[model samples]
Target: MGKVGPPITGLPVMPSDLPLDEVPEDVLREVLEEEKRIYRNRSYKKKPYPTSRDVMEAVREALRVSTRIHPDEFPDVVLHILESKGFEVRHVTVKRIWRAYETLVRKGVIRDELGVMM
Candidate 1:
Protein backbone atom coordinates (compact mmCIF):
# COMPACT_ATOMS: atom_id res chain seq x y z
CA MET A 1 0.00 0.00 0.00
CA GLY A 2 2.87 2.33 0.74
CA LYS A 3 5.07 3.94 -1.91
CA VAL A 4 7.67 1.37 -2.97
CA GLY A 5 10.36 3.41 -4.73
CA PRO A 6 11.36 6.95 -5.81
CA PRO A 7 8.26 8.85 -7.10
CA ILE A 8 9.26 10.03 -10.59
CA THR A 9 7.23 12.55 -12.75
CA GLY A 10 3.96 10.65 -13.32
CA LEU A 11 5.12 7.05 -12.95
CA PRO A 12 3.84 4.81 -10.21
CA VAL A 13 6.36 3.43 -7.72
CA MET A 14 7.19 -0.30 -7.92
CA PRO A 15 9.66 -2.54 -6.17
CA SER A 16 11.79 -3.01 -9.31
CA ASP A 17 12.32 0.67 -10.14
CA LEU A 18 14.14 2.07 -13.23
CA PRO A 19 17.59 2.26 -11.70
CA LEU A 20 18.20 -1.42 -10.94
CA ASP A 21 21.32 -0.69 -8.85
CA GLU A 22 19.64 2.14 -6.96
CA VAL A 23 16.63 0.13 -5.62
CA PRO A 24 17.42 -0.70 -1.98
CA GLU A 25 18.23 -4.29 -0.97
CA ASP A 26 15.27 -4.27 1.46
CA VAL A 27 12.72 -3.54 -1.34
CA LEU A 28 14.12 -6.28 -3.60
CA ARG A 29 14.06 -8.67 -0.65
CA GLU A 30 10.42 -7.79 0.06
CA VAL A 31 9.44 -8.47 -3.57
CA LEU A 32 11.28 -11.81 -3.54
CA GLU A 33 9.58 -12.86 -0.31
CA GLU A 34 6.17 -11.87 -1.69
CA GLU A 35 6.81 -13.90 -4.85
CA LYS A 36 7.85 -16.91 -2.72
CA ARG A 37 4.71 -16.67 -0.63
CA ILE A 38 2.55 -16.57 -3.80
CA TYR A 39 4.36 -19.57 -5.24
CA ARG A 40 3.87 -21.55 -2.04
CA ASN A 41 0.06 -21.18 -2.28
CA ARG A 42 -0.20 -22.60 -5.81
CA SER A 43 -1.49 -26.08 -6.65
CA TYR A 44 1.43 -27.16 -8.81
CA LYS A 45 0.18 -29.52 -11.56
CA LYS A 46 -2.57 -30.92 -9.32
CA LYS A 47 -5.40 -30.00 -11.72
CA PRO A 48 -4.03 -29.45 -15.19
CA TYR A 49 -6.08 -27.75 -17.92
CA PRO A 50 -7.30 -29.75 -20.92
CA THR A 51 -4.99 -29.33 -23.92
CA SER A 52 -5.89 -28.83 -27.61
CA ARG A 53 -5.28 -32.54 -28.13
CA ASP A 54 -7.84 -33.28 -25.47
CA VAL A 55 -10.36 -31.05 -27.24
CA MET A 56 -9.56 -32.80 -30.51
CA GLU A 57 -10.14 -36.14 -28.84
CA ALA A 58 -13.46 -34.90 -27.51
CA VAL A 59 -14.45 -33.60 -30.94
CA ARG A 60 -13.58 -36.92 -32.53
CA GLU A 61 -15.40 -38.85 -29.83
CA ALA A 62 -18.51 -36.73 -30.22
CA LEU A 63 -18.69 -37.35 -33.97
CA ARG A 64 -17.43 -40.95 -34.15
CA VAL A 65 -20.58 -42.57 -32.79
CA SER A 66 -22.61 -44.86 -35.09
CA THR A 67 -25.93 -43.01 -34.72
CA ARG A 68 -27.00 -40.31 -37.14
CA ILE A 69 -26.86 -36.77 -35.74
CA HIS A 70 -27.89 -33.43 -37.15
CA PRO A 71 -25.43 -30.56 -37.45
CA ASP A 72 -27.67 -28.39 -35.24
CA GLU A 73 -27.43 -30.95 -32.39
CA PHE A 74 -23.64 -31.11 -32.46
CA PRO A 75 -22.98 -28.58 -29.72
CA ASP A 76 -25.29 -30.23 -27.17
CA VAL A 77 -23.85 -33.67 -27.86
CA VAL A 78 -20.31 -32.33 -27.66
CA LEU A 79 -21.00 -30.63 -24.34
CA HIS A 80 -22.60 -33.75 -22.90
CA ILE A 81 -19.89 -36.08 -24.10
CA LEU A 82 -16.94 -33.93 -23.04
CA GLU A 83 -18.44 -32.86 -19.70
CA SER A 84 -19.33 -36.44 -18.87
CA LYS A 85 -15.78 -37.43 -19.71
CA GLY A 86 -14.45 -34.74 -17.28
CA PHE A 87 -13.26 -32.18 -19.82
CA GLU A 88 -13.95 -28.57 -18.92
CA VAL A 89 -16.55 -27.78 -21.59
CA ARG A 90 -16.85 -24.08 -22.30
CA HIS A 91 -18.79 -22.20 -24.99
CA VAL A 92 -15.57 -21.59 -26.88
CA THR A 93 -14.67 -25.27 -26.57
CA VAL A 94 -17.97 -26.34 -28.11
CA LYS A 95 -17.43 -23.80 -30.89
CA ARG A 96 -13.98 -25.24 -31.52
CA ILE A 97 -15.38 -28.75 -31.61
CA TRP A 98 -18.10 -27.70 -34.05
CA ARG A 99 -15.53 -26.11 -36.32
CA ALA A 100 -13.41 -29.24 -36.12
CA TYR A 101 -16.45 -31.32 -36.96
CA GLU A 102 -17.17 -29.16 -40.00
CA THR A 103 -13.52 -29.41 -41.01
CA LEU A 104 -13.63 -33.19 -40.76
CA VAL A 105 -16.83 -33.25 -42.79
CA ARG A 106 -15.25 -31.05 -45.46
CA LYS A 107 -12.11 -33.25 -45.55
CA GLY A 108 -14.16 -36.52 -45.69
CA VAL A 109 -12.92 -37.59 -42.24
CA ILE A 110 -16.54 -37.93 -41.33
CA ARG A 111 -18.63 -39.66 -43.97
CA ASP A 112 -21.59 -37.27 -43.96
CA GLU A 113 -22.25 -33.62 -43.14
CA LEU A 114 -25.53 -34.65 -41.55
CA GLY A 115 -23.61 -37.12 -39.29
CA VAL A 116 -25.08 -40.28 -40.84
CA MET A 117 -22.75 -43.26 -40.61
CA MET A 118 -23.58 -44.50 -44.11
Candidate 2:
Protein backbone atom coordinates (compact mmCIF):
# COMPACT_ATOMS: atom_id res chain seq x y z
CA MET A 1 0.00 0.00 0.00
CA GLY A 2 1.23 3.51 -0.85
CA LYS A 3 1.83 5.84 2.09
CA VAL A 4 -0.71 8.68 2.28
CA GLY A 5 1.07 12.02 2.43
CA PRO A 6 0.46 15.73 2.00
CA PRO A 7 -1.68 16.53 -1.06
CA ILE A 8 0.35 17.73 -4.03
CA THR A 9 -0.62 21.25 -5.10
CA GLY A 10 1.26 20.78 -8.46
CA LEU A 11 3.29 23.93 -7.85
CA PRO A 12 6.89 23.66 -8.86
CA VAL A 13 9.45 23.85 -6.04
CA MET A 14 12.58 25.74 -7.09
CA PRO A 15 15.82 24.36 -5.71
CA SER A 16 17.73 26.82 -3.52
CA ASP A 17 20.98 26.24 -5.44
CA LEU A 18 19.31 26.48 -8.87
CA PRO A 19 20.49 29.52 -10.81
CA LEU A 20 17.88 31.85 -12.29
CA ASP A 21 18.88 30.85 -15.85
CA GLU A 22 18.36 27.14 -14.99
CA VAL A 23 14.80 27.58 -13.68
CA PRO A 24 12.13 25.72 -15.72
CA GLU A 25 9.95 27.81 -18.07
CA ASP A 26 6.64 26.90 -16.42
CA VAL A 27 7.88 27.86 -12.93
CA LEU A 28 9.38 31.11 -14.26
CA ARG A 29 6.14 31.86 -16.13
CA GLU A 30 4.15 31.27 -12.92
CA VAL A 31 6.38 33.63 -10.97
CA LEU A 32 6.13 36.31 -13.66
CA GLU A 33 2.34 35.94 -13.79
CA GLU A 34 2.11 36.28 -10.00
CA GLU A 35 4.31 39.39 -10.08
CA LYS A 36 2.15 40.95 -12.80
CA ARG A 37 -1.01 40.17 -10.82
CA ILE A 38 0.51 41.72 -7.71
CA TYR A 39 1.62 44.79 -9.64
CA ARG A 40 -1.84 45.33 -11.17
CA ASN A 41 -3.62 44.80 -7.84
CA ARG A 42 -1.18 47.09 -6.04
CA SER A 43 -1.89 49.88 -8.50
CA TYR A 44 -5.65 49.32 -8.31
CA LYS A 45 -5.65 49.41 -4.49
CA LYS A 46 -3.23 52.31 -4.20
CA LYS A 47 -4.84 55.59 -3.26
CA PRO A 48 -2.48 58.47 -2.54
CA TYR A 49 -5.12 60.79 -1.23
CA PRO A 50 -8.72 59.78 -0.62
CA THR A 51 -11.10 62.72 -0.33
CA SER A 52 -13.33 62.83 2.74
CA ARG A 53 -16.84 64.23 2.17
CA ASP A 54 -17.18 65.10 5.86
CA VAL A 55 -14.15 67.35 5.64
CA MET A 56 -15.51 68.86 2.43
CA GLU A 57 -18.81 69.70 4.17
CA ALA A 58 -16.92 71.20 7.08
CA VAL A 59 -14.92 73.32 4.64
CA ARG A 60 -18.09 74.51 2.92
CA GLU A 61 -19.57 75.41 6.28
CA ALA A 62 -16.39 77.28 7.17
CA LEU A 63 -16.58 79.04 3.81
CA ARG A 64 -20.17 80.13 4.48
CA VAL A 65 -19.28 81.44 7.93
CA SER A 66 -16.04 82.97 6.74
CA THR A 67 -17.74 84.66 3.82
CA ARG A 68 -20.05 86.33 6.29
CA ILE A 69 -17.20 87.26 8.63
CA HIS A 70 -14.37 88.05 6.20
CA PRO A 71 -14.80 87.17 2.59
CA ASP A 72 -11.22 87.98 1.52
CA GLU A 73 -9.56 85.58 3.96
CA PHE A 74 -11.56 82.46 3.22
CA PRO A 75 -8.73 80.01 3.66
CA ASP A 76 -7.48 81.55 6.88
CA VAL A 77 -10.98 81.81 8.31
CA VAL A 78 -11.65 78.20 7.41
CA LEU A 79 -8.39 77.21 9.07
CA HIS A 80 -9.30 79.07 12.23
CA ILE A 81 -12.79 77.59 12.36
CA LEU A 82 -11.55 74.06 11.73
CA GLU A 83 -8.74 74.42 14.28
CA SER A 84 -11.15 75.75 16.90
CA LYS A 85 -13.41 72.81 16.12
CA GLY A 86 -10.55 70.37 17.00
CA PHE A 87 -9.50 69.62 13.44
CA GLU A 88 -5.79 69.57 12.62
CA VAL A 89 -5.65 72.36 10.03
CA ARG A 90 -2.51 73.33 8.19
CA HIS A 91 -2.05 76.16 5.71
CA VAL A 92 -1.61 73.73 2.80
CA THR A 93 -4.43 71.53 4.08
CA VAL A 94 -6.71 74.55 4.26
CA LYS A 95 -5.78 75.45 0.70
CA ARG A 96 -6.52 71.94 -0.59
CA ILE A 97 -9.76 71.71 1.37
CA TRP A 98 -10.94 75.05 0.05
CA ARG A 99 -10.05 74.02 -3.49
CA ALA A 100 -12.09 70.83 -3.13
CA TYR A 101 -15.00 72.85 -1.73
CA GLU A 102 -14.90 75.13 -4.75
CA THR A 103 -14.78 72.18 -7.14
CA LEU A 104 -17.86 70.61 -5.56
CA VAL A 105 -19.67 73.93 -5.61
CA ARG A 106 -18.88 74.39 -9.30
CA LYS A 107 -20.12 70.89 -10.03
CA GLY A 108 -23.37 71.54 -8.12
CA VAL A 109 -22.76 68.42 -6.07
CA ILE A 110 -23.22 70.42 -2.87
CA ARG A 111 -25.05 73.70 -2.19
CA ASP A 112 -23.34 76.81 -0.88
CA GLU A 113 -25.23 78.70 1.76
CA LEU A 114 -24.07 82.13 0.54
CA GLY A 115 -23.68 80.82 -3.01
CA VAL A 116 -20.55 81.00 -5.16
CA MET A 117 -20.62 83.18 -8.28
CA MET A 118 -18.22 80.84 -10.09
Candidate 3:
Protein backbone atom coordinates (compact mmCIF):
# COMPACT_ATOMS: atom_id res chain seq x y z
CA MET A 1 0.00 0.00 0.00
CA GLY A 2 1.21 3.55 -0.87
CA LYS A 3 1.98 5.82 2.11
CA VAL A 4 -0.76 8.42 2.74
CA GLY A 5 0.29 12.06 2.73
CA PRO A 6 -1.32 15.41 3.39
CA PRO A 7 -3.26 16.83 0.44
CA ILE A 8 -1.44 19.46 -1.61
CA THR A 9 -2.70 23.03 -1.24
CA GLY A 10 -2.58 24.74 -4.60
CA LEU A 11 -1.51 28.14 -3.34
CA PRO A 12 -0.87 30.73 -6.02
CA VAL A 13 2.68 30.46 -7.33
CA MET A 14 4.26 33.94 -7.24
CA PRO A 15 6.32 35.13 -10.21
CA SER A 16 10.10 34.66 -9.80
CA ASP A 17 11.93 37.83 -8.77
CA LEU A 18 13.26 39.82 -11.72
CA PRO A 19 14.16 43.51 -11.42
CA LEU A 20 12.26 45.72 -13.90
CA ASP A 21 15.39 47.22 -15.45
CA GLU A 22 16.83 43.72 -16.05
CA VAL A 23 13.67 42.47 -17.83
CA PRO A 24 13.80 42.04 -21.62
CA GLU A 25 13.16 45.28 -23.56
CA ASP A 26 10.02 43.92 -25.30
CA VAL A 27 8.41 42.83 -21.98
CA LEU A 28 9.41 46.11 -20.31
CA ARG A 29 7.86 48.11 -23.18
CA GLU A 30 4.64 46.09 -22.92
CA VAL A 31 4.49 46.69 -19.11
CA LEU A 32 5.10 50.44 -19.58
CA GLU A 33 2.40 50.59 -22.26
CA GLU A 34 -0.07 48.78 -20.01
CA GLU A 35 0.67 51.18 -17.16
CA LYS A 36 0.15 54.17 -19.44
CA ARG A 37 -3.13 52.72 -20.69
CA ILE A 38 -4.34 52.17 -17.12
CA TYR A 39 -3.41 55.72 -16.15
CA ARG A 40 -5.18 57.12 -19.22
CA ASN A 41 -8.40 55.27 -18.33
CA ARG A 42 -8.35 56.27 -14.66
CA SER A 43 -10.85 58.84 -13.45
CA TYR A 44 -9.48 61.75 -11.45
CA LYS A 45 -12.88 62.82 -10.25
CA LYS A 46 -13.49 65.45 -7.58
CA LYS A 47 -16.60 65.84 -5.43
CA PRO A 48 -18.60 69.02 -6.00
CA TYR A 49 -18.56 71.58 -3.19
CA PRO A 50 -21.94 72.27 -1.59
CA THR A 51 -23.27 75.77 -2.01
CA SER A 52 -24.64 77.88 0.87
CA ARG A 53 -28.18 76.79 0.02
CA ASP A 54 -27.10 73.13 -0.10
CA VAL A 55 -25.38 73.53 3.28
CA MET A 56 -28.50 75.11 4.78
CA GLU A 57 -30.72 72.36 3.41
CA ALA A 58 -28.37 69.66 4.74
CA VAL A 59 -28.26 71.32 8.16
CA ARG A 60 -32.04 71.52 8.26
CA GLU A 61 -32.32 67.87 7.26
CA ALA A 62 -29.78 66.89 9.89
CA LEU A 63 -31.69 68.76 12.58
CA ARG A 64 -34.95 67.19 11.51
CA VAL A 65 -33.53 63.66 11.75
CA SER A 66 -31.31 64.13 14.83
CA THR A 67 -33.93 64.58 17.57
CA ARG A 68 -32.40 61.72 19.59
CA ILE A 69 -28.79 62.71 18.83
CA HIS A 70 -26.93 65.14 21.06
CA PRO A 71 -26.64 68.76 19.89
CA ASP A 72 -22.83 68.73 20.33
CA GLU A 73 -22.64 65.75 17.92
CA PHE A 74 -24.76 67.40 15.22
CA PRO A 75 -21.90 68.96 13.26
CA ASP A 76 -19.99 65.69 12.79
CA VAL A 77 -23.15 63.83 11.84
CA VAL A 78 -24.17 66.55 9.42
CA LEU A 79 -20.70 66.62 7.83
CA HIS A 80 -20.73 62.85 7.36
CA ILE A 81 -24.18 62.84 5.78
CA LEU A 82 -23.29 65.67 3.43
CA GLU A 83 -20.06 63.96 2.36
CA SER A 84 -21.88 60.69 1.79
CA LYS A 85 -24.28 62.61 -0.42
CA GLY A 86 -21.26 63.61 -2.62
CA PHE A 87 -20.90 67.11 -1.21
CA GLU A 88 -17.32 68.15 -0.48
CA VAL A 89 -18.07 69.53 2.97
CA ARG A 90 -15.10 70.00 5.28
CA HIS A 91 -14.65 70.86 8.99
CA VAL A 92 -14.69 74.55 8.04
CA THR A 93 -17.91 73.97 6.11
CA VAL A 94 -19.51 72.69 9.32
CA LYS A 95 -18.81 76.08 10.87
CA ARG A 96 -20.39 77.75 7.83
CA ILE A 97 -23.47 75.58 8.28
CA TRP A 98 -23.64 76.56 11.94
CA ARG A 99 -23.41 80.23 11.03
CA ALA A 100 -26.18 79.81 8.49
CA TYR A 101 -28.31 78.05 11.04
CA GLU A 102 -27.76 80.86 13.53
CA THR A 103 -28.77 83.42 10.90
CA LEU A 104 -31.92 81.51 10.10
CA VAL A 105 -32.84 81.38 13.79
CA ARG A 106 -32.09 85.08 14.30
CA LYS A 107 -34.30 86.01 11.35
CA GLY A 108 -37.15 83.81 12.68
CA VAL A 109 -36.90 81.54 9.65
CA ILE A 110 -36.12 78.64 11.95
CA ARG A 111 -37.03 78.20 15.60
CA ASP A 112 -34.37 77.09 18.08
CA GLU A 113 -35.36 74.91 21.00
CA LEU A 114 -32.78 73.67 23.52
CA GLY A 115 -29.95 73.98 20.91
CA VAL A 116 -31.69 71.86 18.26
CA MET A 117 -32.99 74.04 15.48
CA MET A 118 -36.53 73.49 14.34
Screening candidate 1 with a backbone cut-off below 3 angstroms (N, C-alpha, C), the clashing residue pairs are: none
lDDT, candidate 2, 1-118, per-residue tens: 3333444786554454345676699999999999999998876442123236646666777755654644456667655655566655543475586677777778887666545455
C-alpha lDDT of all candidate models, in order: 0.66, 0.61, 0.72
lDDT by residue (1-118, candidate 3, tens digit) is: 3333444575543344333455689988898999999998896798888877777777778878776777678778778778878977654455686787787788886677436554
Q: Candidate 3: where are CA atoms >4 Å away?
A: 1-16, 114-118
Residue 31, model 2: Cα distance from true site in angstroms: 59
Tens-place lDDT digits, model 1, residues 80-118: 776777656554455676666666667766656464333
Q: Pick the candidate with the highest TM-score.
A: 3
Which consecutive 10 residues in model 2 have the weakest lDDT in total? 44-53
Model 3 clashing residue pairs (backbone):
none
Model 3 has an lDDT value of: 0.72
Whichever of 1 and 3 has more lDDT, that candidate is 3
